[model samples]
Target chain A: MKTFFLSDGDLDEFVTNLIAKSPVFAPVAKKTRFVFNQLESVEDLRLDYDTTILPPKKLFVPTKQDLVTFEHGKYEECLAPGKKILFGVHPYDIKAISMMDWIHEESNFDIYYHSNRKATTIIGSNVQNHYKKAFFGSVCKELKVMGHDMFLTKIADGYLVEVLTKKGDDLLPDGNFTDVSKEQIKNAADVNTKADENCPSKLKNTSLEIKHKIRMYYDSDVWKKKSENCFSCGSCNIVCPTCYCFDIQDEWALEPTSGKRYRRWDACLTCEFSEVSVQGGSENFREERAERFRHRIMRKTSFLNDKLGGPACVGCGRCSGTCTADIADPVSIINEIMEK
Target chain B: MSCSSNHDKNIFLPKNAIIRKASQMTAFETHFTLKMEDESEFIYEPGQIVEAGLFGYGEIPLGLSSSPTQQGSFELVVREVGKVSKALCALKAGDTMTIRGPLGKGFPVSEFVGQDVLIVAGGIGLCPTRSMIRYIMDRRDEFKDFKLLFGARSPDELLFEDDLAYWRCSSDVNYLETVDKPNDRWKGNIGVITTLFEGIDHLDPATRVIICGPPIMYKFVIAQLAKYNISEHHIFVDLERRMKCGVGKCGHCQINDKYVCMDGPVFRYSDIKDLEEAI
Candidate 1:
């Protein structure tokens, strides 16, 4: 509920103190790309980085998680991790996390996801630099400035920190930040506006237009032709911030009486995602790659949007960035549809 | 960390139920009467399914075969096809199993009151419709012109022989059965389930037809129903999907935008006819 200014040295001290309080995760450079990892030192917090290889969603809904452990006839649930601070998340990713929160909350109320979400304090930052693949400017134009506990925006020689929640106010009691003037706040707002405009990639059609067109094009040749070069490796799904489809499995111990029931991230692009074995063993479902490909687009653009109030894709561009076959980009596909 | 309080809110936690009676119905099907540990009544409508499974094995969706009118205990007719169904078949009396539900949308029975009722069940599809048959029979005075047309692959595959005999002898109801192929000892009309419709002379437009069978049996049965001039909205069918979670969270049971677990397992033909993957 308050805005303050922090110098470079003061910001570093604030991060160091936050890390000491709890485990902090932030983006760090990994050779040629960036990744979200545990912040061991203040220097590893890449506030000015373009994008992370995988979105911070992994911390909330993990790639693999145990749902329940059973021994004999008794059952025990796997608890969520303790409280932690997720530092330096981008605006688009923060938006994606909010979408995931809504999804898990509205349907069946997934305690696993809700526990982790309640435990973590998100500290988001405005996009100071845009990646070559990112197209958030077109799809996610009106970004929320107040979803996280705190949002940091690069302004002049220092950072403008807007404390949004009560948790963020607790972090500021250490007296590491100075009171922000009206001019400084205005300057910070201008910087964010300019950064939004500077996104390298763009979508030709609006998100709503794309949503309506996707339903009509369910039987289109675009999916079959574009997915021709697809490897079905599920890299797009793995790298996506909003792809939350999972497969449930049971693993038994050697004793046969003890085992764990777990869920792991599963992709629609994979052949087995929609397969169900019936009598005499037959997979009688979405058996074609083209159907699976169309499913992914329909889910992101139309199905989820119709139910959840927004498109599932945040335009973070990780799917496009990670796809080796170069067929997973939503912008390119959407633009192709616009041309037709 | 402390997860005890959160575990209480976990929707996946299944209550323990004991099998009171287990009987082999057919070569591939086993019927079990399950009662909750506390001996409490599990109230549910006809056509609703329960997630039943063992501790070591995972859960599978099984339609309730017993009537909602039956208190304290319910029946499940499991076709021993998959791993979970096979495990359920091996379960005997006094064996413990976990159950979560009375989940999914069920048949609209209240709407069928005072209307001509036609029930078409083929093979194991009779399991779910058995609940409806029992419920309707219990309130037989409220309904009119009750007709049941059942078909099985052969004489050996017909489920609930005892119930069939009662329905055949009952003066108030009309029961017609046909087999795709008859055995040497078989004595009945032999053809697909649709052929049974030709025996009746008067076709009522107000008749509400409920059909459940293998996926392939739907189109033919629906085509025959059209000859009777029944509206699409008048015909109701129960669809089966891979329902991993009884709740809508799991995407497995989804057909397009509709989650079969939440939106329906029982839908009117008019409601889901446009959904290409639903049938």
Candidate 2:
């Protein structure tokens, strides 16, 4: 691993040259919110931002993708991982990506996710400003925020660029590099320490303890009360990085024989998520609103934890913030369950 | 882990298959005989399912009906309930479709090698169980006491009538069928499947009972099985769930910690007895 130093003035020139060379997706202002959009100019990048409205998951598994197409006696797959650099990703989002990797590769390999993940380069950045909904410090207390190819941390001089992989070393600037001093290392460490201390929200228990509670209270009536107001609106699932459920469909053009098959994002909170039976009276296992709500929590807190070695959630707060119903906060729900 | 590796296999891609024959079984049900494009074998167990559908519609999980002993092809009994299933029901001989599976855990048939096997099926649930019944009959010497108790909403709704007639006469199986609403011409027993269980004798705790039917039927059947002192471990249940990828990545088929598409569509009663979502 190698480290590089970039002063404020040097960073501007480097960012400008980098964008000119390849496409870059960095956090940019979406009015009041931030989004990871393609950079039109170096000035549009906002590494000092608080949080993005959607996690970087959309980059790997887009909301919609055309998988296979059949036309004129020919079958074609429109599959490719368009090369782009994802710069200024938060550490928690990287943890979510690691979980997604494990899921897609655990049994039947998802070429769609693997191809995009391989093509994109992730550059992680420390949380310079905290979001009010975030509680990463409470749940993932010991998480190091690894898995990024390169990491950027704010220092007194400028930015401390830590090359964490061979790809990171290859992506480094060609020339005009400066050696890192012990003082710069200390400044980088302080930035990371402040990131953790700045978290404003926290659950009543650690992720593992919460996992135990969720399993023990699988039949608790607390879920019924908390999910009372759920509107079945899936905004929480759309915004969360870990919500990877999808629905597949096919469409034909004016010509009946020619068509394409595609997949779109799906949410388990919907009534039909587990409804496989198309017989006379349909059999939807989680047909009730409260059951669907509990299923979501079960996945994050227990079902996935049993396999992923930790809670699937990284405390991104995307679900909590985007949920229109005030009852979607995992922290508040878990705390109520704990108290009961 | 860094994103430096690449994977080549696309599990979502389905294989081309041609329907050898398709005919209406009931008003809503259509039975199909399908073969791979190359006439390759569809070696699948009793409880395993394949994602099958016409290319222009979409795919849905359909449990295999034909036995693995029936080489070079397989059969499906699909009900016209949704877009994909309706399209499949409409497909006829020589029509093409896509298939992706031999997936999900199947019934533990080998474990029943020398044991008394009691099969209980209701409505269309007999489709998948038919695979095992055929397999067991083909190798009848390996098993003891084979009994099949089946019931349906009406006599007309009962599937695999050919197999039913054959089983009633053959020494290989002791079969009984009942119906909730029997027609005027009907002659067999008239009641729920559990009512037919009393006619079966020489049963003990070791009887390997397999049950498949509507979700509401399990409790009654399991309660009836308790009278014979059959342990939950000796009973197996086949289940179904909405499936997209057939590989378990889509998450629609998940029930608690188990991906029904992976861990099971078939499970021992003792294994999933506590899973509230599973019936």
Candidate 3:
């Protein structure tokens, strides 16, 4: 784990070089918010911003991905994107990606997700700014600088670049550098502590406790009351990094002999998400809006945690920020349940 | 069962299978016997399901209706319910379809040996249970007392009529049936499946009851079984859910924390009794 000091100009040069060789995705300003987009140049990279509109998960599991293409009876698995680099990811988003990795690996071994993950190089940056709604500080105590190829921490004049992997070593800038002394490490730690403290929201209970509380309140009227204004727009699911539920369909070309089978992101909040009609047109499951609401919360805090060993919600607060009905915030929801 | 083929190894990929025979069982249901293109045996347990479909249309999970003892081919009794099943019903003999299976946990027939077997099936729910019934019939000497109780909305909706008649005449097997609304030709019991259990003289404590039906039927059947003093551990149930990927990645088939595709399409009643979504 070698650390180097790079000037602001040197950091820009390194990003420019990396973009020149391969595709580089970094956060850029999108009106009032930020989004992860392909960096045409170093000018678009926004390392000083708060959280992006969507997590870096879209880089691996895109909204719609082709699983296979078929011609009559034969089919071939679709190829994933080539080698690319994702830059300026925050620690919480990195944790979400790791959770997705565990989920895709432990279950069916999703080759589509794994192939994209292998191709993409993750470069995480320390959060210099915090979103007003984000509660990662309270629930994400274990968040650290790991699961990334390189981690960049802001120092006085430039950036403290810590190359953490072999792929990271290749992206190192050829410039004058100094070993990160104990004092520099302490400074980085201080910055992280300050960032954590700056987070405005907090959860009163651990995720495990929240999970148990959810089971106790499984049939509570709180779900119906809280979700009364829900439009079922599913913005909460669309922006979630750990929401990996999808619907698979096959599309035929003009020639019926050839077609493509693909999967697109699906939301549990939607009315028809779990509707399966048997003979005589009778749907068997998940018919109520309140049940759907409870399902989304349970999936984030309890159901997925039971399977993946961690909460699916990373407390990034994108769902709450994007919710039109002023619901879908895990921190508020869990806090309300804990209060009861 | 040589397990050397690429399609057999990959959980996602479907192997090319041809329909060796096909017939309409009822107005809505069709029966098909499918064999791999290479003529390899599609080995599967009685309660497991297969992902079956055409290339243009997507796949859906269908419970395997044939016994494992039957080699070289497997059977599926598909009701023309949805898009995938409608397409499957349209196929005929020699028609090509893709299959990836047999997925999920099947019935534990080996553990039922020397025990009185009680089977309860309702409507098209009889499809998965037929495999188990056929398996038990093939190895009849291995098990002790056998009882089959079937219920349908009407005589028209009843499945496997020939097999039902055979079991009715077999001295070693006790077969009883009922319908919700009887017609002019109907002369048997006219009630729900639970009513068939009322006259039973004895429900052996060692009986392993396998039950399959729509969600509504489970409550009534399980309650009746409880009256007979059948312990939860001795009762096995096959649950049905909307499944996309039978290997468990797709979340469609999950019931609470359990993925029905992986943890089971079949589970011992005791194992899933506490799961609110299961029953």
lDDT of 2 by residue, B100-131 (tens): 88888899888999999999998888998988
lDDT per residue, candidate 2, A68-125, as tens digits?
8987645677687888889899888888887887887777778888788888888888
Q: What's the DockQ of model 2? A: 0.59
Among residues 3 or more apart in sequence or in different chains, the pairs in candidate 2 whose N, CA or C atoms overlap within 3 Å are none
Which stretch of 10 consecutive residues in model 2 chain A shows the poorest summed lDDT?
A138-147
- Candidate 2 at A301: error in angstroms? 0.8
Off by over 4 Å in 3: A140-145, A173-178, B1-10
Q: Which ten residues in a row have the lowest lDDT in candidate 1 chain A?
A: A138-147
DockQ of each candidate's interface versus the true one?
Answer: 0.37, 0.59, 0.42
Q: Native-vs-model 2 lDDT?
A: 0.84
| Per-residue alpha-carbon lDDT of candidate 1 for residues B1-279, written as tens digits (9 for 90 to 100) | 012232336767778899999999999899999999878879899999888988677888888999988888999988888777888899999998888888888999988999999999988889999999998998899899999999999999989999999999997779999999999999899999989988988779879989998888898999988888998998999988777877777677778888887777889999998877777
Q: Model 1 misses residue A206 by how many Å?
A: 2.3
lDDT per residue for candidate 1 within A168-190, as digits (tens), equals 88888653799888999999889
Q: Using DockQ as the measure, which candidate wins?
A: 2
Ranking by DockQ: 2, 3, 1
Model 3 root-mean-square deviation = 2.8
Candidate 1 segments exceeding 4 Å error: A140-146, B1-8
